[model samples]
Target: MNAPPLELLAARGTDLLVRVAAVACAARELPQLAEELAGLVVRCAEELTFCDVYVLDDDGRVLEASNRPPVPLGDADVGWVAAHGCARPHADGRGVAIPVRCDGATIAVVDVRSAGRCRDEDVALATALAGLFAPVLSSCRRLRAAKEREHAAERFAERAVEVQEAERSRLSREIHDGIAQRLAGLGFHLSAAERALPDDLPETAQQIALARRLCDLAAAETRAAIGGLRPPVLDDLGLSAALATLAREATAARLHVSVTVSGELEDALPDHVQTALYRIAQEAVGNCVRHASATCVDLLLEHDRDRVRLTVADDGVGFSIQDVFAPGRRPDSYGLRGMAERAELLGGRVSVTSRPGVGTTVEAVVPVPASRGRREAGGPG
Candidate 1:
């Protein structure tokens, strides 16, 4: 026959003391916690003269032991405790199984096996032990839950950064290609008309010449502003074409640069991938011209079946990537931070390797989802 439910033991005095002591010890031992939870078992073995006792984790693995052979508790035992999270009593061959409660939930079963049948006093002690175990278990549960919440918060923050970068990219494209191009064209026409004006129309010609010069200056300024927003060729001509255009511009500006594309890029890439590569190259070139006192810069674009990559390297003055992102250290350029954030958002990664004299190379790697098929024709504009 089975033993009684755990409630019967709860009604007695000795059981209550064991239960209270267990909880008190758990609280006191915390943060500096150790194994070996013993209250009822100690009391019963010494004062009450009970048989044997053990403590267990929620998994039912024997955790604490006193005057007992180590219990054989495994996944199945824990499964049983998990399935029935309540206190009860059972009488087997040598002892009785009493439910162990921690934080009001039954996590383990305490088996008190005397040489013979156990007394009512022993059952009471076991019930008291369950009560003590409850609060300690509750504390552990709370700690684990808090850790999970923190991890979730970190992920959310990273996602927010990604969204902001995407918005900037979109805005940059609009300002650079649309409005700036129109302004540049208007300036070009104005200059052309001024040059065609009759020299004999002196006063009229002078006014026209000044107007033309103003237009020319305005056009140059607009183009410069547009370049900061986003490179126009990147949006209109795709990555390869865009890099070539940038190279030409750099050459015109007396900066020596070479661009090379490898791999069979016959597979048209996604627009965002193209944009990221273009921006990275654009930023690298800009940095080379401004910060790196180098004579030459190289831009390379490569695409394979699974991923797309861009590399920009210059033989100029290089700064350490570690120092730039270290705590309390400020970046020499905001563009570097922006570039890193962009790659992370796309489930990709960016690495900048540089030394004092060794030139800087910014590499961006982004994975292309297999579900998205490549365009059979030329790359996106």
Candidate 2:
């Protein structure tokens, strides 16, 4: 079959090379542009029976074909093109290998083979297409690198939270076991002294009684501190009881708070998921109390066999979500961003819906299997 004129093919190919660049730029990796690269070469350079795209492996010694299986090309010019950043024509005049360069180094080699003698225009067209792809490949590499770094940062942040929770647990144990126990012992001794003091020494009895009361107060405060560090109820009972306790102890002076936990598999959640849920609820409640001057708040948690959903809704003075989540405009005490980041780290999500004077609802949905799969030791319980 006769092919289009060389001038027309060259003109059309040059125009489509721009399309190639657009495709390659959006592509996150080389393999994504493999088919386009092969088609570009074959359609424009019609003398070629086939086209092959090869990228260097990490070691830079082996070549990897992105479009098809690697075969013995029986021509070593592909390597020469990659190494020298120049096109190498087959000694038999049937093929040409063109280097795809970025920043003075070749990232790929394009090989076009003909059934007969390869046209000079076909070889030049191959070279021009390779040049167009080079910059786009560079951009793709940068994008992939940025994504890898973002993933690394997420891992680091999650690990940091885990370490912080471990420390909190250790401190809680120290306070509960050491200081609280000693205070209790001191209170017992003070009580015994007060009881032994007779009706004759009224002043002395009053002083001992006061000391005992102070000791009891100190012990209560210590226990409260332990609960704050990492609530013991979360470990002793489970997430539902812990959320109920959280609801009771919430410092919403004006809001009437209610916690309703209903689920078939309340005990199925992992430790981290439970902890994250608790924290997200805590943040939402805090937001409601401090920002949303709502009259009432509801903490609802429901779980099925597969996943868990916790919703914190408040009928308060709601604000625009766009304003809250705006870049560089987050309020000083806003925890929505932190909540979202934490949920994402655990393979979950938090959605907040609100408007001016309407209401605000924060809903967190987490897949139990995914969270359980990446479960760590501790979190903000």
Candidate 3:
């Protein structure tokens, strides 16, 4: 056999380098990379006439293929390379099987086929190409793993929110049916007893009056608890009315809070969406009163054609947003996390902006299904 000319070898080497770079750039995903690798092996080696690529997943099953039919998992040569993480010529001396590794673990096996027998140079080139793919594949695998974990976390968060809501509903019913009812009945009995007292029994009448006052206080407290557990306004009047009630309560707490609406919100939102937005607003307002020390707060609800936005802004002394969200910086930032989790479950997002001197604003934007009427003309019920 005659040696190829130096010029021909140099040209092939340059062409191979260019082709490898192209393959690297084009290999974004596992399947695309596998196909490119198989094609590159054949094109890079002058002795190879035809080539086939097979990419095996972690379980030794064929994940992708290029220019060839799927290879059986039980093929001795392919299985051996996958199991032992090595490279070798095919049993019939027509191709090479190379194990693709990442972080010291075999992830895939690349099988390159040729019409004629493969040469030593061909095998070496195929091995080098597979080596180049290892890191890329590793990075891709890690990315995919990270995405899967994120999805799992979101799923877990959603489930937690659902359970929390269920528990709240149950507790609210218990408080309303058991405690609130009993308190109301007690108030009625106290009134009846006071009426039955004689005009001459002044001391007894005074004691009865004090007992009635105490019964009224207890009943009021029970009603407050029931409202806190589950706001009846939310179910009866929808999100806008519920937010108006929140603003009124904030005002009573000495926080100058106002509620504003941009678009008419006549049509009711999905129950879950309305609940999430209301909770977010409620938490934001509470945070302002508790920590912001702001004299005035503004709550805005905007209903657009496709989405609704809620903004809670307070003209108070603001804190560092980063520090609040940083690890171990603020242990009391669970409210913010809860807000974000709730919005995320509805495929929405929450954003908070604040500076040291300027006011802070928390905004939540949630996409509404098109099936829901956007142009409905109604005010907060």
lDDT of 3 by residue, 175-200 (tens): 88898888888888888988998899
lDDT of 2 by residue, 1-381 (tens): 123334433576566656555656555465566556777778766587888888765445665686455433323787777777777888998998878888877777888999999887677777777776677666655654564565465456557667767898999999988999999899889988887888999999888888888999999889878887898888888888988888777743666789987777634676767778887887888788788988889889987766789999999999888887787886733589878877887767999999999999999997664232332321111
Ranking by lDDT: 3, 2, 1
- Candidate 3 Cα outliers beyond 4 Å, as residue runs: 1-19, 35-79, 88-96, 112-128, 202-206, 231-245, 251-256, 259-280, 287-295, 300-312, 315-381
lDDT of 3: 0.76
Instruction: For residue 221, give model 2's deviation from the true position in Å.
Output: 1.8
Error of 2 at 352 (Å): 12
TM-scores for candidates 1 onward, in order:
0.45, 0.55, 0.60
Candidate 1 versus the native: TM-score?
Answer: 0.45
Candidate 1: worst 10 consecutive residues by lDDT? Answer: 372-381
Top-lDDT candidate index: 3
Total colliding residue pairs, candidate 3? 0
Top-TM-score structure, candidate number: 3
